[model samples]
Target: MAKTQVEYAVEGIVTRQMIEIGKKEGIDPQWVQKRVSEGRIVVPLNINRPCSVVGIGMGLTTKINASIGTSTDIADIDAEVEKAIAAEEAGADTLMELSVGGDLNKIRKEVLAAVSLPVGNVPLYQAFCEAKQKYGDPNKLDQEMLFDLIERQCEDGMSFMAIHCGINLYTIERLEKQGYRYGGLVSKGGASMVAWMKKN
Candidate 1:
């Protein structure tokens, strides 16, 4: 297991990524390390992928994370890679591959290779998409499969992930208790999760 930035910071050590980000932010590397140790800053650089280092959190510049994805109707890896490169060229601080179609792993790899920006993703999208394709229903998603997908995505060098840790049974119960919700949920992953919860 590798030591995280926070762990290294706690030990009074500054990582090269911290120094690079510090230079970009015009702050001292020690200050960046201190903030990281204090949980006030995040440098989303995955060990498996070497790309530009970006800092997000308090006192840092606001980062624009551009999302590039493919739906079932239009799953084009080449186009998604172009979008990833375009986002980077357009000064995006970070990029997220949210493709739910085609070979997701291949698409992610191509997108990651397309630019120097740190890349992220929503693991649930792949998990749900795979489940739906395999079983003809997203509701048939297996718990183990979801966990495995998360691990695989991490291994694939996703610097960040949009994991829905807040939408659990307790939240669902409160949602049902409230009743008459306006504007319903707009997130596909969220909607599928709620449906799965209701069924199970």
Candidate 2:
């Protein structure tokens, strides 16, 4: 339990927690051990996270993630917090704070403090919004601004980040050649970048 997957596999000892959980689920303990030994399954137990449940991935029961947050037009932190609580009570495996409006830091911290489950976010949305407000040109957004926002989110205890790293300069060219469809890049980050590209 105190080591990586490779380290645990080398030991060849079935962890008691795995065995107990498998027994409760009516699964073979050895099968659980084998799956854990492989890298296919990840038990994301952050040292700071207080949740006791162990999540099983890859062929496990389907899980749902509920996204709750404030939009630029509807920047209500209290409402967003309430929505997050409601989502948790409604059985969401995880919550994502997709708040692009209001005090982003305050909203994220409030949600994290209110929930025991994992929290995720997309740092680029906050970055793009802030950049546009400060510089009047979204494309003028600096890499440092994005990195600082990510670091701030991590410091505020975000368990995961949805970064669009693959959509870089070259990818834009490819997308341009592909041309626009009805929706035209539904990704918020992609759309924001395209808007900035058009404006600049």
Candidate 3:
């Protein structure tokens, strides 16, 4: 298996990605490597996706992440690709393809191809959406299915993922005990996970 950036950093190897980010951030590559080894920095470039890299975390520039995706009512792949391009052109350091509608796999690949910015996604979005469509209830989302989807997305060259592994029974209990928040839970993936936890 190929080593991760963290693994390489721990071994004191200054990778090409670190050098590129160092050049871009106007910092020493060794400084970047030190921060990465200490887990204070991240360069989110997937080995499978050969894109321009960006370093995020302590001491680096505050990078902007632009989100583009297809909604249920507006699942236009071409439009989403255009949005990805526009985000890159407008100076976004990263991109999140959060599509929950209309051939999500294809949409992700197209967007990845459209921009050199590191691309990420919320795997739970696709898992919950597919479960809701297949079983008529997001609550019935299978654990194996979710894991498989995550692996597939990674294999498809998603540079990173916003996995909701933090949501569990304990979190649900805490939320229930705390009553209502200002906005409650506005996240679609978060709400789906809560609903699944509540039902199961």
lDDT of 3 by residue, 19-67 (tens): 9989999999999999999999998877788887889999999999999
List candidate 1 segments past 4 Å from native.
Answer: none
Q: Candidate 2, residues 78-196: lDDT per residue as tens digits?
A: 89889888988988877888998898888888888888767888888899888989998667888799898887877677767788766666677887888876787889876776666
Q: RMSD, model 3, all Cα superposed?
A: 1.1
The superposed Cα distance between candidate 1 and the true structure at residue 175, in angstroms, equals 1.1
- Model 3's number of clashes is 0
Lowest summed lDDT window (length 10), candidate 3: 188-197
Q: Order of all candidates by lDDT, from best down to worst? A: 3, 1, 2
The digit string of per-residue lDDT tens for model 1 on 1-200 reads 89988899999999998899889999999999999999999988888988888899988999998989998899999899889988998999999888988999899888887898989888888998888889999789899999999888888888888887669999888888999889877787788788988887
Q: How many residue pairs clash in each candidate?
A: 0, 0, 0
Candidates 1 and 3 compared by TM-score, better number? 3
Best by TM-score: 3
Candidates in order, TM-scores: namely 0.94, 0.76, 0.96
lDDT of 2: 0.73
lDDT over C-alpha atoms for residue 18 of model 3:
94
Worst 10 residues of 1 by lDDT: 183-192
- Model 3 stretches with alpha carbons more than 4 Å out: none
